[model samples]
Target: MSNDFFSTSNRIKSTPFTSRNNMAGVKKYSVYNNTLIPTVFRSLKSDYFHLIKHVQIWDVCCQKVIEVRGNNALSLMKYLFCRDFSKIVSGKSYYAPIVNFEGGLLNDPVVFCVEKDHFLISLSDSDLFNWVSAINHTKEFYADVNETDILTIAIQGPKSEKLISKIFGEEIKFLKYFNFKKFFFNKESLIISKTGFSKQSGYEILLTNPNNGILLWDLIMEKGKEFNIKVGCPNMIERVENNLLSYGNEMTNKDTPYDCGLGKFCNLETEYEYIGKSSLLKQKQVGFEKDIFKIHFNYEFDDQPIFFNNLPVFKKGIEIGKATSIVWSPKYSKYIGFLIASKKIMNNLNDYYILDKGKFEVSEIL
Candidate 1:
């Protein structure tokens, strides 16, 4: 990959771009912080409601996909995860946490079932390729794995059904969440899945060619004109309210899936053994000291300036917990944030006060 592949611009512009095939002109936007580009795109609204009511498209190339193929792929996956992939059917998806032996979450990636024998792992910010390599280092495993650079476009909103129907027809409407269907555009095969980060209904198109990315983007925007379509990224307010956790924000390497409130997804029912099963089983029996919880704060704070408590929130100067992501919900007309605190502290909810710039009592917990 070349550094010149990415360039900065003040406005969205159409330029000659190269994909797996050849040069195809596509429109690109130059964003400030590359990490925030996804959120920024979703913030732009064409309707009165914060929701992207009509339609919206995203060039989420930043989220890379790694494909694992060849014999023993399933076995390798079985060794790497606690999720029972054996039950996953082709064209479906499963969400699981890839953990180490000590039960630390390495990366929370979505495992997509492209075929009974092959799979694609979608990663957020972590380098999944390195993780895959580390798994392969155990010579006892027999599998061929390769990582591929892929680009994806997310088409979301209520009108998404109608717009996608025009291209793929009414069959697409039946595609269940976490399910995918394959279609051809310009004689090239593309996979579209009924999944996205937003709680709202949507579809994501995976394309190998970058040129096709621009064409699909333009086509959706053009066709979406009647639907009052807009271009944007995933809705932050909607995601948080729905309890959809992001990678680095809600969970990290230091946190186990159980601690992050994803313990239900951890499957201990399987006869086949996995890497972190022992630790997870032990944690389950012993119970966790802290658990992720949704907390509503009673305070007014600016959204831009990342707010942090001035004094360490404590029970008689003994720290109990700290706040994570916080946002003011215009719809709910209240302040909401996520917190990881001692189970003892949570038991006494009335005593817990969030020190958001100043001390404020916790209004409620969900």
Candidate 2:
């Protein structure tokens, strides 16, 4: 492993569970949303297998919540993303891409409808608060936009439901996917939702008090002892295989929602108007010229692949696209990742070369 300099300061915040992570011997961290996110604890392959077979408690406080409350909260939401809010009933969450006026992706957040008028935008790694605040300031909307102190913790894996049920009761295990319910822990009410970034069966606890962070972590760890719970963050290999897209990793402000394969989430012809609706409609008419793909290598890689940015992909010695995310999957025994390619190459999911050497095959997100 190579040592990279990462400084700590007021700007880079640590979650309340940082100490616990330290105790767990967290090996590495990556910054997300100006917060320290644990990238590894044990070895990568070990952590990946643990996450697949057992349970993991992840300090996902970096998944910040931008709360929108008041009469015009729905109006602000309507103007922010392209999702049809009418379909998002209370106690449910909807994944939507927040775009700017030019149809460029600002952030892809999971909007949670907490109540009739109150909603929480659980954002990815982006400054969504500023955008919402600016919108509220310019318009005479009755919505209040502010970042909440609520820290998010995720319990994920095959055994997550059993472990959560041991503490929160069996009723919580029955909570439908994408639904949330308020539960009390030590007499403090906190929200737990059946939503997570991982494809594994899991729940994200939206903790209200930062003080309860370690307390909750301890309780879960204690109860989850039987299930062999591990302290792990999001696994790159698993996410790539599942085709989960990261915000800054897969798509950014430079790309539109259509470019990131988010067109299905957009309803351009809806009666409701949102920010970038016009741009999205125009882009829809023009159609997407570039998009993301999930690719698999023909041969195994001796070393795990980590891509911070795009890696040039070539076809017949000519650069055609760039890969955003890469990982060597132990489950599939293959190198798998996501890449952006032109419509011509993207339409034909076939053999290609990366780094002008390796043979690979690409496919749409399955």
Candidate 3:
């Protein structure tokens, strides 16, 4: 890779863990949420194996939060996302899918209940921050909406509990999945949640104090050495195998939840009004013409495979739909990826093929 591939500039901000990531000799970088995120370290394959076996620390500060507080905070939450927030308890989190008025998928973010009337929309790579701010200003709701400086550090893998217990004590293991609690580290209050990007059991610590970023990273590395912990990023192959969808790749503003295989997350029975409630109800009734599918490439390639977004999906020379975010899966021994194609083609998987340099079969629907 050339230096020009991802040159450093003022426009592309660096996270608090940038220096630590450089010390780890990060191999590659990817822009996420306008921040430089470590993509690879030693090697993708080696990192994947280590992550599954041991544990690794990930600097995911790029998972920015859109903080909403004040009297109408809950109102704003109900107005934006499709998930029913009626049952959301304090100190817990829920995966909420934000959508446009037309029911197009805007962004899928995890909503954290910090206080009785306070919520944090920990977002993926999208400009939903601006959208939220605009909505707050226009609505004049009794709520304050602004971006918070809560940096997230992820300790992921099987031995994640072992590593976290050393610092936070064994009681840290008691936190249930998708639940978060405030704890003291160096007498400074911080939030740790049993949530992560990978399917593996882990936790993401939200550091309110920016100064503790390097200290926390160094402590984890120092305490984690006995566990053979390594610095790594989210593995592409592992995420694909788990059917984890990536924003700006698997689906975008042009796509709806139905098209992206996220219909189950949408709450249609709720009587409370949401941004796209009516549109989503209509979409649910009419049904989707296309949906997401997993593709498997037959040929082999040593280098990383490149997928052109919206690559034509063909069936007996007739175009049905398009593919996006195709990645080679070493675990499955094939190039597997996510794509959106006609429901007809997805149902009759024996016929459809992804048109790339060569044809690849639509392996599975997940």
Candidate 4:
């Protein structure tokens, strides 16, 4: 999460409603897209339980959106591999894995079809806007790419529906998962989507007017008082248990879509030409050696393994993989993590070790 003090700079930015986060007792912060995001409101352990039981408003403005306009917007989207965007219609959000020419992962973002020929690509941690802009630089596709001034706020948790209904009304029930609709609140239009990074069901509200951010946040907070709603951020423990992958933590530019276990979304065919079509096709035929898995570490309740960095995994002295994300799952009363391991090296019986540290139990992500 955060190291605390947030001083806005050119590179490290602050959102419009960042003051609200600080006022809400935000304890930690993480810089995403150059914006200071509240990673922890109270404490990870306490905030996590509250998030699952009640409701939380998250300042996710760091999750920026890249707007693409014109007739070739769909064509540009087609160039984004590991997903078929031809069938994607307006009002839907697709979890598309953006890949490069070498089939290496770029950014796994949700592409929102706002309207026909108008789309928004919500980014993760990376500066994918330049890459995307460069792709359409020649204007050959006739697609204009620009970063939107919009900011995002997420209402996540089990009680998220009830909290959102208090302001948005009961009609929100009709909004399906990965679906978004324009709603005007206090005369300000907001695109609300039934999607979030948490395992808990939630909605992400896209604020076009940055000035209206605090206004909207305050409105939700007031309505959320009944639901015991608290200001929150993405909990590492909850995400680890839920296997909700974070870009820089779970993956990087070196990893491919297949390595990330995103092959199911890769609809590779000769019909659609994308950046990584050839390499993905080759990997499809040759197969991937490394893949991601969920690991169950030593499960003693007192075994609070707090290694902040990744621990390498080995089988009989042969390096197999490493635990990319690790946490103590309070709900499970055990240590769990997402391991990026090689398939060939994973065939063993109780021989896995965290390098020279010690022996540990390994489990695959289901």
Please, what is the whole-model Cα lDDT of each candidate in the order they appear? 0.68, 0.82, 0.83, 0.82
Could you say which candidate leads in lDDT? 3
Candidate 3 clashes between residue pairs 3 or more apart in a chain or in different chains: none
When 1 and 2 are scored with TM-score, the better candidate is 2
User: Which residue runs of candidate 1 sit more than 4 Å off their true CA positions?
Assistant: 1-36, 41-52, 300-317, 357-359
- Going through the candidates in the order shown, the clash numbers are 3, 0, 0, 2
What value does the lDDT take at residue 76 in candidate 1? 85
**In model 2, which range of ten residues has the least summed lDDT?**
357-366
**CA shift of 28, model 1, Å:** 14
TM-score for every candidate vs. truth? 0.85, 0.93, 0.94, 0.94
Query: Over the stretch 119-145, how does candidate 1's per-residue lDDT look in tens digits?
Result: 888776566677777787664565667
Better of 2 and 3 by lDDT: 3
RMSD in Å for all candidates: 5.2, 2.6, 2.2, 2.2
Total backbone collisions, model 4: 2
Question: For model 3, how does the per-residue alpha-carbon lDDT over 86-128 read when each residue is reduced to its tens digit?
Answer: 7779999988889999989889998999986999889888979
lDDT at residue 287 of model 3 (Cα atoms):
83
Model 4 lDDT-worst window of ten? 299-308
Estimate, for each residue in 1-366, the C-alpha lDDT of model 4 and write its tens digit.
123475556878878878888788888787988888887777788898998899899989899899999988888888764698778899999988988889888999988998879999899999998889888875378698999988999999999998887788899988999999999987978899999989899999998876678888998899899999898988888888787888988898888878878877778864868898898788778888778877776543454554345877766676666777677778776667777767766655355455424555454343
Error of 4 at 366 (Å): 5.8
